[model samples]
Target: MTFWALLILTALLIAAFLGYAMFRGRKNREPAAAYDLRVYREQLAGVDRDLARGVVSEADAERVRTEISRRILAADAQMQAQTDQDGPPLWANVVAISVVAAVLVGGGFWMYRQMGAAGLPDQPLELRKEMAEALRADRPSQAQVEADLPAAPQPQLDESYAALLEQLRETVSARPDDLQGHILLAQHEANAGNFRAAYAAQQRVIELSGDAAPADAYSHLAEMMILSANGYVSPEAEEALKQALQRDPRHGPANYYLGQMMVQVGRPDIGYRIWIDALRVAPPGAPWVEAIYAQLDDLAFRAGVFNPPNIPAPSGPSREDIDAAAALTPEERQEMIQGMVNQLSDRLATEGGPVEDWAQLIAALGVLGEGQRAIDIMKEAVDIFAGDTEALELLDAAAFQAGIAQ
Candidate 1:
């Protein structure tokens, strides 16, 4: 109900109460005048009979009858006045009812029109449900996103990464005899952030090399495995590298890799010991000397127990060391050193480090008295090297020695 409707209803209720009060109030306002008409008539008739029977004087009867008639007339006039006092007007009642009805209907219609004009919509369950669903559907899972990815052309980096992986796989599979291929595959996998896969590939190389020439393969595989292990090298991998070290106590790569692994695993003392061993075994002009120095500095910083002085700047091969190596006769030294170098280089080719691994394989073949195989390996290396002068010269010399050239 509107304000106007409430006001009108209140007015109607008040009027009705007032009317009832008037009706009730009027009940006891006038006193009761017991003018019993039947008693008056009977008493008058008895007086007349007495007058007729000469039982009473005429004057007395006449006076009594006149007094009784006066009382009756007064009573009738008072009753008429009482009946006409203070009744509610019919016109007033009709007007009040009209006003109440008008207020109720008019207020209701006006409110309805105002609300409609303002576009006050009703609450919709369907719209609320749809909004909830839309909010929930906006977010998708990783698997869902991957599934919805379009067949669009890949970016250059992605394409190159995929091609590199495919080439590595093909090279590994096609050239099982080529240890260098497996090594390259492992290196590429490492570069691509697949450390586990790289470690697995190196492990295969170690397995293939067997006991005869496992030093370099063990070194490479141990390096990758330790790197993959992060700061906690597995006991299994650690033991494998130690076994390799025992076989060739002066194996430079194995010692260096193991030292690095030890440092990573929070064994700085052991790492330092292994690094010292590495320095002693590695040649004067070894290629990895600078890398070893950096590792030592890192381990020392992490240990925090005692600060060690920086390793002295690396120097070239000492004159004394060169002179001592040169003192031996060329033929005898070549024959002896060639055997060691061939074994080491063949291991390097299998473990996959340098691009010149194919040439190393050729060198090893020639040293092992397989001249024809050496010639073929050299040709393959030349084909791979293409415009490289060193590879061309090496290939020509090997071919001449094998009697396969003019």
Candidate 2:
């Protein structure tokens, strides 16, 4: 109210001052013709004085007086003409003042509506933090989110595999306290595209392990929960991610999901920081590296980061290798590829490499028509990257190319 009152009052005052100046200027002005008439009359009086003092000849004085009289007549005629043509009417001034006042006040209000925070209250740092906390606390639970989601399409299964999966499920149900049974059930359920069941089984496994459960167990649980919810990080999944981070602060899967949860909860600043730190220390083919790279620009923008660090591309087969392969005959190329694959396999077995090496080996084996070998390597890679969703996805793509079950 005070802001509005001050703005209106200032505008009115300026308009009134301008209108007064216009009227006062006209009133104070002496007409040009009137001034000219007075000067000419003074010259005529000087000519008369000159004649009386005998300072000039009578003819010279008479000629001066006639010229002065003629100038006086012309000046008087101009003054009368000016008086007949008066200044503008008073109503015209009033209308102009009203327009100026309206424009000043109305234009100011329009500009404020476009650019000012007319109604919003100021938000301090503490208030924003409190709002974020409230948002986090109000997120939906896993079950609630899942309930609202559309039913997932069921995968088609061979009769024998279906029977085996059913038998395993029955066995796990019978032996409720068996940790290994629960773990196997979780793995089989997830493989069969039954994520809800998979998470439930994983939860049981964590319960059986109690304090002995590793970060991977909690991370796996979160992964299954998120998948079941179609990529939404529910409150339960966030709790699992928290537990995983509590166990191993550098756990890749946990950190990735934690960042995602922070973004969902309207804390992109924290999410950007978490993802940046994770990417810095992450291996070339760490599961979350690609995901982080994809979202880095948007995350930086939301976090108000104008200049972000460059994200290096993931490592892959060298250009030299491709050129060498291109120069070889078909038989020679096959031999060279096989030799390279064998060397990679040997090196990975002797000293475990990043997940990229394992994926590359699987793909190479598939290209060489060694489907069984590719399948074997994929199984091993899956075990190594159990809780990592992105790594598993890479391995799955390799397996699909190898004509193996995902």
Candidate 3:
């Protein structure tokens, strides 16, 4: 039945029940009718005997008999009035009980009709089958589901990268003497976003290559060091850079990175010279040459030095202008390059030429709360090179200038 229908029926049933109770109370009369004549006579006789024996006065005896009669008559009249009222028949009571039972059963069934068999506790076997079907909908048949489920869903990237790093580690461990393996492992670690492991792996490469060979090993080591030093650099990684540099002074990456590290640790002049030397030895169009040159520019900028001084502009067409006074000679390129080097040297000699120049500028600017400028200069360097010494030196200088270093 609808909710309203059930409510109306319940109210009617309650009213009927109350009416029946009231009816039964009226019909099942107490023994309030007149007392039996035999009992009354006996009681009156006993009272009379008492009066005759002088235990009571005739007036008192009469009063007691009269009072008792009055009470008995009042009780009998009340009982007879009660017996005259209406009451439920036995059949009516039985029907009410059947009606209540039917209401309860029908109401329960109506509510249960809204529920599905999926919710039935006795149908667990069916529920399992449904769940298996759901899984099959999303997964390929060939893919195996584990007998034991995971506590929660795992990130695919997290799992994939973690596995890659693990494989790289195993490869490096198995081939301890393979410098290339270490380099590959380091790159793998870097790709997997594990900078610390990458740094360590690069350090291993430097160690395997030793002092004389593998010019790029030091450079890679320096890259790792710079990355590590940016809160990314670890002490162990720093040690690795040191080892790489120890293997070769002219190792381009090593010299550049170590020089920057040195400046970060408060040796800007050495850092500047190292960067300059890196630029000098680096071949044009070499893999890392542009990066080295950018670092030099960055260093000059941070030192508050702009362009180099006293290099006459090229006099003729690009090729001829770069040549020497001897027209037939191939000295133009050499002269132009020398002029460029001289220009770099002159700029280095100015107020903000080298590490010391940057240090002074950073300090002076810091005192004036020009930290943004200092930071700007450093950022410019970072923009030009991935891991340059000049950039590192400026980072250190800025930090020191800002009173970050103790």
Best by TM-score: 2
Worst 10 residues of 3 by lDDT: 140-149
Off by over 4 Å in 1: 1-161, 170-181, 261-267, 285-287, 295-312, 316-406
Off by over 4 Å in 3: 1-165, 170-181, 203-215, 231-247, 292-298, 301-406
- Which pairs clash inside model 3? 32-76, 33-76, 211-247, 219-253, 228-232, 228-233, 229-233, 322-332, 323-332, 324-332
Better lDDT candidate (1, 3): 1
Better of 1 and 2 by lDDT: 2
TM-score of 3: 0.31
lDDT of 1 by residue, 65-94 (tens): 898788766766666666443445556655
Candidate 2 clash pair list: none
Candidate 2, 1-406: lDDT as tens digits: 8877887898889888998998897677778888888788888888889889999999999888888888888888878777643577778878988899899889988888787875578988789878888999998888899889888789898899899999999999899998877876887788899999999999998898798676778888999999999888989999899998887687777899889888888889999999888877776656477778778889999888998877567554566976878989999987887888899999998898878678778877866769788988888889999999868766764554343533
lDDT of 2: 0.82
RMSD of 2: 13.0
Q: Give the Cα error of residue 232 in candidate 2, in Å.
A: 2.2
How accurate locally, in lDDT, is each candidate?
A: 0.60, 0.82, 0.54
Which whole-number lDDT from 0 to 100 does residue 142 have in model 1? 29
Rank order by lDDT, top first?
A: 2, 1, 3
The RMSD of every model to the true structure, in order and in angstroms, is 36.6, 13.0, 29.6
- Model 3 score (lDDT): 0.54
